[model samples]
Target chain A: MIEVKDLSFAYRTGEADAVPALRDLNLKIEPGQLVAIIGHNGSGKSTLAKLLCAVLYPTEGEIRIDGVPVREENQWEVRRRVAVVFQDPDDQLVMNRVEDDVAFGPENLGLPREEIAERVRSSLEALGLVEIGGRLIEDLSPGQKQRVAIAGALAMRPRFLVLDEPTSLLPVPVARRLISTVGDLNRREGMGVLHVTHSMSEAALFERVVVMDEGCLVLDGTPAEVFRHVERLREIGLDVPLAASLAHRLRSRGTPLEGDILDGADLRNALAAVRESTAS
Target chain B: MLELQRNVIFGQFVDTGSPIHKMDARIKLIATFVFIVASFLIDSFLGFALVLPLLALIQLISRVPAGYVLRGSRFFLGFLVFILFFQVLFYPGEVPESSYLWRWGFLSISTTGLYTAGILGLRVIFLYYVTTMLMLTTSLVDLTNGLELIFGPLQRIRVPVNELVLVFVIAIKFVPIFIGEVERLARAQTARGVPFDEGGAFKRARRLGRLLVPIFISGFARADLLTTAMNTRSYRGGRYRTKLRQLHSTATDWLMLLLVVAWMLAAWQLPDRLLS
Candidate 1:
């Protein structure tokens, strides 16, 4: 499990006063849980992702990865436990070739060649990128490049995978495919996922959804529970998923939709139920 | 109109999986240096006949097409020929009477001048071939590992060899990226009515310079992102860092090294005896 206890982070800008990015955030992620973080730009979602991966240290409180505190001394351990995939696929991939880029993480950890090769193979296979393993990273499509980035992280064999806005640059279908692949990894491998995204639709797919606003964790619940707070979410400059918005509209029109509808399937079932009621 | 991608193939590596391609990169690097230095040592055309065959043998082992290598060097071949022409026409230091074939006001052609130009041209070709072959055979990761290993001892003297190696790696990796960026920038400018190809040399250069602003800004942005990526991957420089693929020289590598040493010795000594 990953635990964040009263974690606060402030960026030391040029001036004497530091800009606070996160304030006393408390959270816990159980193993194999798929969690999505949603917020507006500069809503501290990226900051929280960074802190979880120890890219940025918490100014106050502590972050413990698999029970090891995220300090300078335990940095490697923390990194080994939690690997992060950043937004831009081009930026994250350091190697020219796909296999080499995937192997980069394990190589940095100083694993043996055989082991690194094994990890590279397995990670590529896991991401369905075995065919492009030998190809140049520049030649691959943006979706494939992002998968390569994730494979790079997976090769490290981290317990928790933290992806910060991974699909922001990807096309809608490509982004959806990428998320499903990630979801498959979480389901099959039992890997804990902390996905930070701006897409309400994407957020609604997760098992749990967390919302950040003005450097504070304002809402935390299941996707259905969180999407129900449509007005509150809108107040924070965030949108509800399409289904949830439709449900909210229907409720406002006195259709009496009983529950939160965060996905297309849910909306379909709910609409069918309404039709059956009216027909009866 | 300039096919930048086609022209910039200096560091393009071909994965032929040949013996030379599989040879430890450090050994290849050392051998390249030895061969280049040996190229300068050969004084006679007879020596070059011996050396050129050896170079051809290395190229053969690398399995990269000789035509491809030659095509890659086509951009610089014009410059090389121009320099050779000037060297042959203008005998700078001294002109022996017996060696002079033709004479004009300040330009003269001599046997010595011809020989000097030929040797200089051969030197340029050999140097280019050696470096190009090295790149053609070795992947960038292997190249970086080889560089770090070769310069590994310098770390004791606080030379920051790892950082230097990273700089080299990043610089090399960015060549194709920047080339593509320039292409895109040029295309955008072309859409905006910039005549990139219809201009004279000066106009073309100035128009090309206009593309640099966006490329540079994007380059800086990329550098920023790359820095974060590198740091996130736990790149703390060369200190206490270990490699996944520990470079181990094979029997072929050793044999190649030995052959290079022997060739260097022969090239150094045989040229004088043959020339005299």
Candidate 2:
């Protein structure tokens, strides 16, 4: 489990009047849980992820991962335990080849050659990239390259995986694939996934959702509970999920359709339930 | 001849199971030196005929098509022809030693100048092919590694081997990126009504200046980002850097190296005409 107590961070631009990105954010995430943090463009979601990964140190307060505080001395160790996949593949990918790039993390960890090789194979296999392990990262499609990035993170064998708007720049199909894969990792392996996204549908994939606004945690609950605050999401310039929007419309029409619908499949099942009730 | 030169330069170094490609790059580097030296020693038609066949044999074993090699060689054909023409015109014709091959008014062409021109042409052509073979078969990483190994002793005097290799790698990496950027800039300029083609030399120079500003800015930005990324990954200087795939000299490598060395030594000892 990870705990953050009054964590606040500001960008040091060598100025006296620097504005804080994350303002007194208090959050606690349980182990083996997928937590979705959704926010508007400048809502400090990315800054929060960076702070969590120890990429940027906090200006004030404390962040404890497995009872160890993330400070300057323990920064590298913290990062080893927490791997972050950035939004841009180009920014994260350093090597020319896919296997080499994936192996980079383990290599830096100074693992034995056999262990590094095994990790590379397992990570690539986990991402369904066992065949194209030798291919150039540049030659792969965007979806494949993003998977390669995920494989690179997976190779690190980090307990906590933090992804900052990873699906924001991807196409719908690619985004869905990424979400499913991340979800699978969280569910099957108990890999703690902290997915930072503005997509309401992506938030629905996670068990718990944390909605952030103006550098503050505004709403935090299960998808159904959090999404029920529809006007609040809209007021913060965030779009509600299609099913939730439709469910709200139907609810206004006095139909007994469930307002807990987040995905299309959920809506379909809800409609089936309505039909079954009417038939009975 | 010009066309052949271009083909030779351009063709050859793609990945193939060629003997040259399979050989250690260090040996190939040494062989190329010896080959270049042997070509310069070749002075006469007989010498050229002998050396040309050897070059052909080397190419055959390289497994790269002779036609492709010659296609690459064509790029430098213009320069080769110019050199040959200059030599033929400038070399003085001694009378009575050899009969005039051709005579036009005050100008007389003798066998001596013709022979010299032929030898020079052959030497140029052979050297070009040998260099192309070295480049085509060897990967950039291998070439740099070999260079570093050869220049390793220079590091004792603080010659900055790693820095030099870094420069070479960075140059190779940025060339394509810069070319793409230039293409984009040229299109942008054309769209803005700047006629790059119609400009005079000075006007063209001005247009190039305009193009360079954007390219430099973008290149600098990219370089900053790449530096940050590389540093974050802990890629310091190349000192004590262990490569995952290392270059090792095999039996074939040694054999080829020995053959080239023997040929160079024999050519050095032969008579001037034979050597040529």
Candidate 3:
């Protein structure tokens, strides 16, 4: 499990004024958990992701990967265990060839030829990039390049994978398919995933959703648990699904809606059960 | 409107699966070094006559289309010819009166000058062709690995061969990306009615100045990203870095090396004797 102990981070600009990006944020993500951290821009979701990856150390508090506290000396271990796929694929993919790019992480680890080859092959296969392994990265679409970037990270065989707005630049269908692939990876490989996104629908797909507002995590629970805070999420400049919004409004007007409502289907089921109970 | 990626053919590898393409990159690098040396050494017309066929043969065996060479060299070739004209017109060497074809004081065109210009032209042309073919056939990764393994002995002198190779490989790999960015920036300017194509050199450069600043900013930003990405991927220079693929030298590679040596020797010694 990856654990955060009251993690807080601030960027120092000028001497006296250090901008706080994360304020006493605590999160626990176990392996195979599909968790989404949702917030508007500058809400510290990405800050938390970077802290977990050890790309940026916390100004205060700690992030422990598999029980070891993340620090400068052991940052390499954190990197190996927690792989991050940043926003732009073009920025991360350094190699021209797809297979070579995928092999980059393992290559850096200095694995033997056979092991590296196996990892590259398997990673390519995992991302459905087997056929285009030899293709140039320039020739690939933005979505395909994103897939290649993920494949490179996967080759590291990290226990936790963090995606910080990976679908922001991708088309809708491509982003959906990529997310579905990521979901399958989380289940099949049983790696912990923290998907940091602003899309409410995308966040809803996760088993757990964490809401961030102004550098603090405001809500953390199942999607239904989190989405039920429609007015609260709206106040924080984030959208909620329409059904959840309706459910929240109805519950405010003295309706006995007890469960977390995520979608139209969940709202319909709850309303039907409520009507049947009233008739009985 | 500019398709910069399509326009870029340099430092690109064509996977033709040809005999020459399959040859070991170590041998290719060593042979290319020899070719560079021989290009400067072989001076006679007979020597060039002997070398041209060898390059053409290798090109044919590599299966890389000749259009790549011609298209890539068009501007360079034109510039070379123009430089050769000036070189012949103002030949600075001891131009004996007997070798002068037409005399007008310092502006005479001499047979010796023409001969020297011809030799210079051939040397540069061959150098460009051979190196271009090497790049077209050998992938950058193979080239990097080849250089590292070939220069593996230099680490005893604390040469940092692997880091140097990384720099070289990354620079070469960034060529297409850099070009694509220029295209994107240029197209963006064009879309905003900046008029990139409608200007003299001075005005064009002024417009390009606008593009250059952003390219540099983006370039620095990309370099930062690449560094962080490599770091997150656990890249710590060349030490403790292992390659997934190993290059093996086949009999064909040995044969190709042998042929290059034979050609070099022949071009060095047999030129005047055989042709005379």
Candidate 4:
């Protein structure tokens, strides 16, 4: 399990007025749990992601990966437990070829050559990227490149995978596919996923959703429970998923849509049930 | 109009499933250094003639097309010709009266000058080919590993050999990236009415200066992102880093090393006045 306690982070901008990016935030992610963190720009979601991977230390409180506190001496251990995939795949891929890039993580960990090679093969196969393993990263499409980035993280054999807005640079269909792949990995491998995104639709697919506003966790629950707060989400300048927004409009118009609709299928089933009741 | 991608092939690696390509990169690196030094030692045309068969044998073993390898050195070939012209025309070295072919106001041509120019051209070509072959066969990762192992001893003297190798490898890798970036920037500037190709040398250079600012800024931004990415992947320099592909020398590698050493010895002992 990954745990954060009263985490607060402040960046020193060399000015007297230093504003903290995160304030008194606490979170825990159990193994195999897939959670999404959604917020508007500058809401400290990315900062939390960075902190989870020990990229940036918290000014107050501490983060722990499986009871090991994140500190300087245990950085490699912490990183080995939690691997991060950043937004831009272009910047994240250090090697030219896909296989070499995936091998980078294990290589850094000083694994044996045979073990590193095995991890590279397994990671690429896990992502269904074995065909492009020998291809140059520059030649791959953005979606493929993003998959390569994920493969690199996977090769590290981390228990927790933190993706910081991984789909921000991808096209809609590509993003959907990539998220589905990530979801499959979480389900199959029992790896905990902490996905940071701005898309409510994307967050709705997660097992739990955490809403951040002004460096504080404003809402946390299942997607069905969280998307029910349409007004609060809009007030924070965050959009609810399309289905939830539609359901909210119908309820406000006195159509008795009695439940939170977090996805298209949920809205469809709910609308059909309402029609049957009205017809009866 | 900027076909920069097609034109810039120097230092680019081509994967040809050949024996030479499969050899350990450290072996190739050392052999290349040895061959280059031997090339400089051989002053006679007959020495170069003797080395031609060996070069051909390597090319055959590498399976890389001769034309493809030669094409990468096109730009250097032009520069070599320019230098050879100057050397032959000026004839800087002392010339015997009998050997002088022509002389006019600090410009002279002689038999020895022609021989010197030929030898110098051969040396340049040999150096270029050896280095180019090394790159064509070895990937950047192998190059980095080989260099670090080769220079591993220097770390005891407080030299940041790992970081230096990382910097060198990154710099080499960035060549194609920056070339593409420059192409994109030039295209954008062209769309914005900047005439990059219509000016004289100074004017073109001034126009290029405008392009450098954005490139440098973007380069810095990329470096920042790369550092974060690398750190996240647990890259803490080369202090305790292990390689996925270790360099193991096979029997063929040892044989090749032996052959290179023997060739260097022969070149050192060969007669330099074979054609004189």
Candidate 5:
């Protein structure tokens, strides 16, 4: 399990003045958990993602990965478990070609030739990138490049994959497909995922959602429980899923809708049930 | 905007599955060294006459188009002409008064100047051809592996061979990426009415200078990301890194190395006096 206790972080802009990015926050992610953290700009979701990956350490508190405190001396332990895919694919990819880039992580671990090759092959196949294994990264589409970046990260076989808006630059359909793939990887392989995104629809797809506002963890539960606080979310410059917002609007207009609605299917069924109950 | 990726093919690989492309990168590297040495040793035009046919033969064997190969060098060759013209105009080398083809206050062209400039130009072209062919045939992976292994002995003496070779390889690999960035910036400038293509060489050069600022800024940003990405992947300067692909030289590579060595020796013994 990854544990964060009273974690606070700030970026030092000057010698005396420091900008607080993450206030004292506490969260726990169990093994094999799939969670999404949603927040607006400057809400500290990205900062939390970076801190979890050991790229940035907390200033006031501690993060423990599998019981070991994440410190500079034991950073590799944190990194060995949590791998992050950054926002831009161009920034992360070092190799010219797809397969080479996938193999890069395994090669860095100083794995033997056979193991590295196997990792590269499996990573490429997992990301459905085997066809373009030999193609140049520069020639790939933005979607393909993002997929390649994810594949490179997956090659490391980290227990928790932290995706920091990996699909923010992609088209909607492409982003949906990429998120669906990550969801499948989570369910089928029992891999942990901390998908930090601003898209509420994408967050709604995950099992659990964590809401961050002003560097504090304001809400944490199943998607249904989190999306129920649409007012709080809106006040923090965040939006709930479209279906949830529609359902909330209907309820406020004196239309009774039952149960916490998160996605379109839930809203549709709830509205149908309300109609059926009225007719009966 | 230019076809920054497609048009720049001189240093890009063209995999033909030919024997030359399949040869060990070490042999190609050694052959390139030999060709550079031969370019310096052979002072006679007749020597280049022999060397040119050999390069052509290798080009044919490599199966890349002759037109494309020549097109790759067109811009460099144009610039080379201007350079050689200045070299001949200055005629800084000591020349007999009777040997002067044309003479002015500080501007002169002599037989010796002509000969010196001609030889230097040919040598440079030779170097360019050999290096370009090496790049066109060998992939960056092979180049890095070859360089690391070639300099592996220096590691015992505390030289960071693997890191140095990786730095060199990454620089060459990013050349096209940066070129594409420049092309995009130029297009942006043109869209904003910069008159990029309407200028002479001097104006074109000054305009090109404007693109460098953003390129460097973007380059640094990219570098920062790449560094973090590399660190996140556990890259520790390649100290304990084991390669996924190992280099294995073949008989054909050995034979190619032998042939190049022999040719370099023969070219060195060419008679410059007879050509004069």
Candidate 6:
């Protein structure tokens, strides 16, 4: 299990005034679970992600993995456990070639040559990037580069994967494919996932959703339960998915839809069921 | 043309199959020194005639284009022209034989002056081609490795050969990055309506100052991140380091090296008066 208990952070050594990037935040996540953290920009989503991966030490409180606290002494181990896919793919790719880039993390651990090769092949295969393994990272498209970044993290074989807006800048279809790939990894490989996103559509696909407001976790629950609090979500400058919005509007029009209509196809089916009932 | 051809020296590795490329870099460095000495020794017109053909033959064996060498030597050409003009116009005393190539007002040419200009120009050309060939064919890694090997004896005096090699590797890697950054900064300055070309000397200097601010800022930011990444990978100082590509000597390399040594000896043994 991964746990963050009352963690806060500040970056204040520069000319910029000291300001808390993350307030007193706390959360716990078990293995093999997909959790979505939704928040606007500068609402502490990225800072929390960095802290979880041990990229930045928490200024106060403690973070632990399986009861072992994350401190300076155990940072390398923590990093090996939790792999972070950064927002920018350019910053994450350490090598020029695709295969070399994917093998970077494993090589850093000083793995044997054969083992590194095996990990690189398996990671590329997992991300469906086997064909582009020999190509350079700069030659790949934005979506392909994002997949390559994910493959690099996968090569490390971390138990928990933290992605900070992995598909926020991608086209809608590419984002869908990336999230579906994440879903596959979560289910098939038994890896814990913390996907930070601003898209309501993407967040609705997660098993659990946590919303942040002004550097604090304001709400945390299942997607359906969270979306039910429509007014609260709006007050925090967030939105519900289109399907949920339409379902709520229909309910206000004296035609209630049953079950949580989060996806577009589900909403269509629910509307069809309602029409059948009215005809009868 | 000079301003545009500045990137020619930055021609990193073209993989030409020239004699310079075939020889071990250690041997090449020695050959370059010998060739430079020969150019200086042979100051007569006949000597230049022999040296130019030899330079051309070297270029042919390397398979690198001749235009590249010419383009890479632009600054050297300018400097050579300046030196030639100084020697021809201001040689202290009176001329023994005034050979008027072109009498343009106060400027008059003499046989000694013409000979001086020819020798100096030919020597400069020889130097440029030798250096260009060395850089074009040898990879930066191989060059550093060769340097370390050539200076291996200095290790007895506590010289840091490995540290020097590492520094060269890092410098070569950062050169391209720094160039790209300067290009970006220049573009940003241009976008701000700062005409870098149309300014007086001081104005141009001030414009450069404005451009450096952001470049340094971004460069420091990148350096901090790179240092963190390097530290995370445990990149300590080079001690007990193993290389992925080891330098191996071949029969062809040895043969070419022998030929160069024999030629250098023959040239040096030739009568000094004939050589001049």
Judging by DockQ, tell me the better candidate of 2 and 4: 4
Would you estimate the TM-scores of all the predictions?
0.85, 0.73, 0.90, 0.87, 0.93, 0.71
Off by over 4 Å in 3: A13-17, A249-260, A264-280, B44-46, B73-121, B201-206, B274-276
Residue-by-residue lDDT tens digits, candidate 6, B106-136 = 6767666777777778777777777667767
Clashes of each: 0, 24, 0, 0, 0, 1
Worst 10 residues of 5 chain B by lDDT: B1-10
**Candidate 3 colliding pairs:** none
Candidate 1: tens digits of C-alpha lDDT, residues A123-209: 999999999888888778999999999999998888999999999999999999999999999998899999999898899889999
| Candidate 1 lDDT tens digits, B94-129 | 865777788898898888888888888888888888
Candidate 3 scores a chain A TM-score of: 0.93
Candidate 1 chain A lowest-lDDT run of ten: A256-265
Q: Rank the candidates by DockQ, best first.
A: 3, 4, 5, 1, 2, 6
Interface root mean square deviation per prediction:
1.8, 3.7, 1.0, 1.0, 1.2, 4.5
lDDT of 4: 0.87
TM-score of chain A of each: 0.96, 0.94, 0.93, 0.96, 0.96, 0.94
lDDT of residue A37 for candidate 3: 93
Writing each residue's lDDT as its tens digit, candidate 3 over B128-242 gives: 8888788888877788889999999999999999999988888777776788899899999899998877767578668878988899999899988888889889998899788
Best by TM-score: 5
- Cα lDDT tens digits for candidate 6, A1-280: 8988998888773447977887888999998789999998888988888777776788888899767677877877787788878666765565556886676677667667788888889889989999988775656888999999888888778888989898987999999999999999889889999999999889999999999988899889898888888888888889898788778778888886888878789889998998998899
True contacts kept of each: 0.44, 0.08, 0.79, 0.79, 0.65, 0.03
Q: DockQ of each model against the real complex?
A: 0.46, 0.18, 0.68, 0.68, 0.68, 0.16
Measure candidate 3: CA RMSD.
3.1
Model 6: DockQ score? 0.16
Q: Stretches of candidate 4 above 4 Å error?
A: A17-19, B44-53, B65-71, B74-122, B153-161, B261-273
User: Candidate 1 at residue A260, lDDT?
Assistant: 64
C-alpha-based local distance difference test score of model 5: 0.85
